[model samples]
Target: MKGRTIVLDHIDDREAAALMVDGKLEDFLIVGDAPAPGTIYRARADRPVKGQGGMFLTTPDGPAFLRQVKGLSPGALMLVQVSGYAEPGKALPVTDRVLFKSRFAIVTPDAPGLNISRSIRDEDERDRLLEIAHECMDGSSYGLILRSSCAGEDAGEIAEDINAMLAHADQVINDPETEPELLLEGDGPHVLAWRDWTDPAEVVTQAGGFDTHGVLDALDVARGVSEPLPGGGHLYIQPTRALIAVDVNTGADTSLAAGTKANFACAKALARALRVRGLGGQITVDLAPMPKKDRRGFESALRAALKADPIETTMAGWTPLGHFELQRKRARIPLSEVLK
Candidate 1:
C-alpha cells in the first residue's frame, strides 16, 4: 500500500489566524470577528404568536426575510437575538438577556427560514434583532464556534465569555459615554483551538516574542525561552486534518529471515509506532504472509501484542492479496509529526 496525501481548501480567513492542533492538514474557523468572539443571542419569548393577530406570525415571508438577511446565506448559523420582556405596551429595555439553547445551532437550509416565533412590539428592537440574525447568517456575528475545545466547558464559563463579548460590543457602540479611542477587538478561544487542531507540530515562538506569556498562559503550559531556530514561526503538535493513511512495510532481509519471525517483527514495530505517535483512523498493513505452518500462531501473537497499546486497533482478516486491514482510533495528529 502507498501513503495517502490529504488535501484541504476553501478556508475562511478567520480560520487561518487560529492556532493549529494538528500540523498536517486539519482546517477550522471561528464563526465571527476577532477580539470579542463567540456571542450567544436569545429572544424574550420562545413563541410570540397570538391568535387573531391577522399577521403571518409563524415566520416571515421567504422573499422578504431573504432580502432582510441578504448578507446571510441559506445554511449559515442563526443565534436568535435575545432581550428582556416588558409588560404589555411597555417600553423595551436598552440591554438584553441571553439564555443558552445548547450553545450554538447549525443554521439549516429552509425556504421561509427557521421560525424564530419571538416577537417584539417596538420596531427598533425588532430591527436590532433582525440585524443580529443577519449577521449570524452572513458568518459575521461574534466569533463563536461549537468545537471539541468546549467539550468539558461548564455553562458559567461559556456564559462569562459570551457576556464579555456583548458588553464589549455594547461599549463600542456607546463610546460617546466612555470616550473610546482604540476599539476593543479579539477573537474567541475557538480561533486558537482551530489553529491548534490544524498544526501537527508543537507551536514554537522565539524569545521576546509578542504575547508569549499570554499564549502559553491560555494553553496552561509552562513558558520557557529556548534558543531561536533559523526560521521564526509558531510550533504545534497536531495535524490540520483528521484523516490519515499509513502503509506498513517489511524490509527485504527481514522477509529472508524466518517468515514468521518477520511478520511478527513488522506487527510489533507497527504497534509500537501507533502507540507512541498516537496514530488514528483506518490503518491498512500490507504484508508478506508467514509460511503456511506459521500463519495462525503469528496472527494470535500479533493481536496479543497490540492489546496494551494506547490506541484501539482491530485486525480484519487478511485479504486474498495478503493485505491486512486495521481500524485504529482517530488521532489528533499523524505519527510522522509526533515522532518528529
Candidate 2:
C-alpha cells in the first residue's frame, strides 16, 4: 500500500501488468486484439491516398496506414513498424522510422550517432557510458541511444544489452523479403513491464497478483465514469465518438476558492485516470466555473500534471468558451474497448 508495487498478472489468460502507487493504480497495460505497437513488418506499398499524403500498406494482420510517406511506388517493399493502436474499423497506424528499443539501449537505423540520455547529468557517468558505447558500437553505422536506466547500472550488463540489441537490429535489417511479412512481434505486457518499469520496486510475479495487490479493486474503481477528487469534489470522464469529455463538479463546498480547488484536483485526477485507462485522443475539459484571474493558475497546474505523464500530449489552449483542450497520442487502446 506504499511506494511502487508492480503486479504481473493475467486477465482472461492474456498478459497484463499494473503499477500501484500508494495503493492506487497509477498505470496499467494489457494485451489487446490489435497488433501491438513496435511490431515490425516488411510491407509492400499499396495505392496512395491522393489528399492525405499517406498510403495503405498490406500487412499480415490487416491494412496498415503510413503517413508522410512519399517516393514509394506500388509493389515496392519497405520495412515499417506499428506506431500505436488504431481506432475500430480503421487501418493500423504505422511509421517508417523504425527503432529497436530495449531496456538499456535503443538502436536507430538510418540515424548515425551515439548518444546518452540527458537525464543522466553526471559527467563522469556520461563519460563511462560513452566509452562503453564506443567499445560496443565500433564500426557500426547505425545510431545508439543509451537509456537513462544505464545510469549507475552494471557496466558489463549495459554493454551486453547494447550488443544484443545491435545484433538483433542487424538480423532484422538484412532480411531480403519483397512481400508483406511479419518480421518481429511486439513485446507483451510482461516484457514491457520489465523494460519500462526499471525503477526499484516490489515485483509480484505470482499468479493472482492483481487481486492480492489490490489492482483489481482499483481497476474496478477506474472502470466507472465518476472519479473522486480531493475535498469532496468529483470528475466524470466519458468518451464520446468525437472526443473525451471531463466534467468537474464542486460539491456542497460553496465557500470561496472551491472552484479553483476542484479545478486543480481535476487536473491530477483526470491525468491519472486517463493514463491508467489508456485513454487518448482529443480531450475537452468542462472546468468548474472560477474567476478569470484564477484561470492562469488552473492552466499552470494542468500543464504541470501533464508534464509528469509519459505519453505525448499537447495542450491546445483554452477555447473561447473557457473549455480546455488537449490532444493525446493513441499510444494504447482504450481499456473499455479492450476489456469488452
Candidate 3:
C-alpha cells in the first residue's frame, strides 16, 4: 500500500490500486474503485438512430450491474435500459452492456404504454420529483424504477418511474462534452436504507447531501394518521442479523411510561416498524402474545393502547405459535428486498 491516490472524472480500468498510511486512510485514498458497472455509459454505440427522436441503446457491460441485483440465489434481477430508440422502432439484438438477470432473453425493449408528467408550480418547492424528472429525462421519454418495485407495486407508479428513467437517459444523451455515465444507480434496498447519524435538521436543508427526503415524506403523509411525534428525522438505520434493525430511541422524551407502558410500548414499536420497514399498502402484524397472566386484560389493554395512532390498523387474530397476526398495508420496501 505505497502508491499515491488518483481521483478522476471517471475510472478507466476495472481494477485500480491505492495506499494506506499511519493506520489512517486519507480522503483521497478512501475513494477506492469499487466501481458499479452499467449504471453509467462511457461510449455512444456504433448503431444508428432509427426514429423521430434520435435514440441509442446501451447495454450492461460488466457483471457488477447484474451482481448488484443478484440475490443469495444464482439468479439476479435484470434491469434493461433502452435509450435513444423510441417506441414503434424495430427490435434489435441485445447489446453486451445490457446485463440480463438470468440470461439475455429475459430483458426486452419496447415503448411504454402510459404517459406521466410532473411539474413544480410553487416557489418554495421541497418536493422536486418534477425537477428530478426533468434532470432525468434530458428531454425524451424513458422509464425506469428502483429495485423497490419488486414489492408488489401497481402499474401507475411503475409507469411514472419508467418515464423518469427515460428522463435520466435523456440527460446522459444530451451531454457530449462530458463523459456520460450513470449518475445515480439504485442501490440494494437494504443497503440504501442504512441510517445516517447526523444532525437531522441540517441534513434536511443541505444543498447537496444524502437526504432521506423520500422516506421522510412518506412518514409525514402517514403522520398523525399513523402516529404522533412525526419521525424526529434523526434516524439510526443500519443492517443487522435480522431484517433492517430500526431502533427508535427518543432524545428529549425520557418518560418511563414511553418505555414501560404495554400499549405505549407496542404502539411506538409498531409505528417505528411501519415507517422503517416501509410497509405500505397493507401489512400483517403479529404481536408477541400479551403476557399470559392477564389474557383478556392484556388484549383489552393493547386495543385501548393503540387507539391514539391514526393509520387504519387492526388486530386480526393470534396464531398457535403464540404470535398475534394482523394485516397491514404492504409498503414497497417491505416487498422489494428480494435479496434476503
Candidate that would win on lDDT: 2
For candidate 1, the lDDT comes to 0.35
lDDT (Cα, 0-100) at 271 in candidate 3: 42
Q: Any runs in candidate 1 off by more than 4 Å, and if so which?
A: 1-257, 335-340
Using Cα atoms with residue i matched to residue i, what is each candidate's TM-score against the true structure?
0.29, 0.98, 0.26
Question: Residue 74 in model 3: shift from native, Å?
Answer: 12
lDDT per residue, candidate 1, 60-108, as tens digits? Answer: 1011011122233333323322121212232222112222222322222
Q: Relative to the unseen true structure, what is the C-alpha lDDT of residue 268 in candidate 3, on a scale of 0 to 100? A: 40
How many residue pairs clash per model? 50, 0, 36
Among all windows of 10 consecutive residues in model 1, the one with the lowest summed lDDT is 57-66
Ten-residue stretch with the least lDDT total in model 3: 99-108
Task: Give me the candidate number with maximum TM-score.
Answer: 2
Runs in model 3 deviating more than 4 A are 1-111, 115-167, 171-184, 187-318, 324-340
- Model 2 residue 324 CA deviation in Å: 0.6
